[model samples]
Target chain A: GGIITQTPKFLIGQEGQKLTLKCQQNFNHDTMYWYRQDSGKGLRLIYYSITENDLQKGDLSEGYDASREKKSSFSLTVTSAQKNEMAVFLCASSIRLGGHAETLYFGSGTRLTVL
Target chain B: GDSVTQKEGLVTLTEGLPVMLNCTYQTIYSNAFLFWYVHYLNESPRLLLKSSTDNKRTEHQGFHATLHKSSSSFHLQKSSAQLSDSALYYCALSHTGYQNFYFGKGTSLTVIP
Candidate 1:
């Protein structure tokens, strides 16, 4: 059994400040993703990486940046934290299913509170 | 645009009652994939069920759902509700050959003991 760990379960950031969230997976999955969850809103994908050094933008990637520095880790950075922004950031990883598609295993999530 | 819709934002039911949460979707691709994810409070959402073939029932962990391509719906159902079954359920969709996922505004189920 493997686990997906996310750093800083609770984050309090200042407005306009840059915040970074980290995720590490022990499953050795090839695909990683970052998603945001706001109250009463569905999970929105911010970024997804198919392999190392590859990034795909999702609908909610405008104010975020992602990096896949290694196979076991993926990171998301909020370029400019917006005021009153409170959302849970989730990290997920999965094996590359290509045409078959695979299930995503998610981390516990990092809840962000921008003051 | 591709999207998923899960109505019934808050469903309150007594334990041991029949469970059903409505989920509908819209996509341009014919062969799209539909999925249900269960998220407990303050926890990451876990994939509960997934299916691509229409009219086929997919069951897992006492939960069952079927992807009806003709109706573009994948409604989640359970025979009996348990107090532990209370959680937020999300409906998601993806195209056949693409990896992008679009999720619906989740449904929260609260089973009272």
Candidate 2:
């Protein structure tokens, strides 16, 4: 009965500005992830953390950075927003149970638009 | 590198018809897991079905999918499509003992009344 909360559900940013999206999960899960969703492209992993203070670069992490300072929170920052960039960023977390396949619980998402 | 592929970008169907979304994957690991996730508008994307055992059909909320290791496919299907079933679907792959997962481009299903 836990929830994932993402702040600033809709975001508008200026080109070249740094934008940060925040996610907090009360699931107490050990693994957290950030994903970007485009119109046609499925969700692409931006970054992931196995535990607090850990970070793993995903396939599309070139222009993004993530922080996992606490187990309950994970934040993603766009290094420099691009003009006309628009995408929905999702945050998810999972519980690691030995060798079992973990199910991901996701936050609603942060929709970003850069002018 | 591990990856998932969902060929159909969008599917339109009348209610009461059958529904099928094709999913295929490529990975070096043998014990990889395949999943079907549904995303309804204004809701968080959630897991619909998952399978790791080859040829074992996994069903949830009237949807079913079987992971066929031989074919490298895990397609989602439903016998009766409903208007409320309209949503975006995604196929994902994850390796055993690891949390890193890869997702395919989503398939948007529109079931009209």
Residue-by-residue lDDT tens digits, candidate 1, B39-84? 9986778999999887899999999999988888899999999999
Specify the CAPRI tier of model 1.
medium
DockQ of each: 0.63, 0.73
True lDDT of residue B22, candidate 1: 94
Span of ten consecutive residues with least summed lDDT in model 1 chain B: B93-102
Q: Which candidate is the best by lDDT?
A: 2
Q: What CAPRI-style quality would you assign to candidate 2?
A: medium
Q: How well does candidate 2 match the true structure in TM-score terms?
A: 0.97
- What's the lDDT for residue A48 in model 2? 95
Model 1: pairs clashing at backbone N, Cα or C within 3 Å? none
What DockQ would you assign to candidate 1? 0.63
Isolated chain A: TM-score per model? 0.96, 0.97
